[model samples]
Target: MKISIITVCYNSATTIEKTILSVASQTYVNIEYIIVDGNSKDNTLEILKKHENKISKWISEPDKGLYDAMNKGVAMATGDLIGILNSDDTFHSNTVIEDIVNFHKKNDIEASVGNIVQHRENGKIVRLYSSKYWTPEKLTIGFMPPHPSIFFKAALFNKFGNYDLGFKIGADYELITRFFLRNKIVWEYSGITTTAMLVGGLSSSGTSSYKLITKEIQKALAMNGIAFSSFKIKMRFFWKIIGFLKK
Candidate 1:
């Protein structure tokens, strides 16, 4: 099965090349690598050109936001399965794509979720984000599999729709909850660490950002008609602390 991986970025030159090389080194052959740049002002564009041969398709243009750029990348994809890799993340291993494909085929599932190692810029591991502990019911508590480690059959997007542009930090959480909870897409854990994510990204920042995302998660649940309590949502941070200790 062909897999399409999309990396979305803006002024991400500091770590974009590692992300590019990670995908380019994947053992899976029938893969398409697409990058959507939000008209970066840095050398990100130059780096893209330097590794142009590794990219199947790429576009440099202004976008509404992160989710908007992701939507553009999805529109450009032609592979049967699609996954998004953040600009600051890299595959845990060269065989990650191959492993994900095998897991999906073996289980006969339309989507797959794996684990991720969130690490600092100095390459210090922070926590292990695993799908084995995730469930659709956990959405009420603002929990989700690491976005970089989830892959879905492209058709699922056609059925459920793209990320809601209304959210800034929680769109990934919102969309995943929508698919796994509301639409009930079939998904299984791949039992592989798919991505090594940098510790600081859109959703991985500090306290103020966490508060904003918590509010957005609540909004997402309400929008989906899912019954949730603010207390349950706040408990997600407790689980997050557990994740760090487990790591």
Candidate 2:
């Protein structure tokens, strides 16, 4: 099966090369690498050109934001499977894609996800979150798989829909809820680690993290058509704080 991996970037010259090398060095041959740049003013485009031969398709132009650029990449992708790799993240190993394909072949699953290692800016490993087994109830309590480690069949997007551009911070969470949680897609958990992600991502930033989590809870409730009391939401936040404290 052909797998399409997309990297959406903007002014990411510092880490773009590593991301490109990670994908290019994959053992899986039936892969398409696409990069969508939001008109990066830095040398990101130049770096991409240097590895143009390895990349299947790339576009550098002004766009709305991260999700907008991701939409363009998804639209251009022709592979049967799709996954997104942030410009700041890299695969855990060269055979990660090959392992994913082998798992897909063995199991009749519409999507697959693995574990992720979160690393600091100084290249220090922080925490490891495993996306082994997931359910809607787990999601309601604010548990979510790392988006970068998720690989879904391209046809699933057609059945569900693209990322909701309406949400700035929680669109990925919303998509996860809609496709995997609500619709109950057949997803396989490999238990093997997949991606090494940079610690300081958009969702993990300062006050935005709180805002995004609140929005995610609201979106989850609305999408699932569930009524949640304020007390329940507060309890959810309490559980989240407990989870963080334990970590």
Give candidates' CA RMSD values in order: 1.6, 2.0
TM-score for candidate 2, please give it. 0.93
In terms of lDDT, model 1 sits at: 0.91
Cα-based TM-score, every candidate: 0.96, 0.93
Report lDDT (Cα) of residue 197, candidate 2: 93
Residue 67 Cα positional deviation in candidate 1, in Å, after optimal superposition? 0.2
Instruction: State the lDDT of candidate 1 residue by residue for 1-247, as single tens digits.
Output: 9999999999999999999999989989999999999999999999999999999999999999999999999999999999999998899999999998888888978888889998888999978878897889989988888888899999988888998899988899889988999888888888899999888788767999989999999999999989998997887878778876996
lDDT of 2 by residue, 92-204 (tens): 89999999999989999999888999998887999887775555556665667888888999998889999888877778888888887788899878876889999888878
lDDT of 1 at 72: 93
Clash totals for all candidate models: 0, 0
Best by lDDT: 1
Q: After superposition, how far is residue 72 of candidate 1 from its true place, in Å?
A: 0.4
Clashes of 2: 0
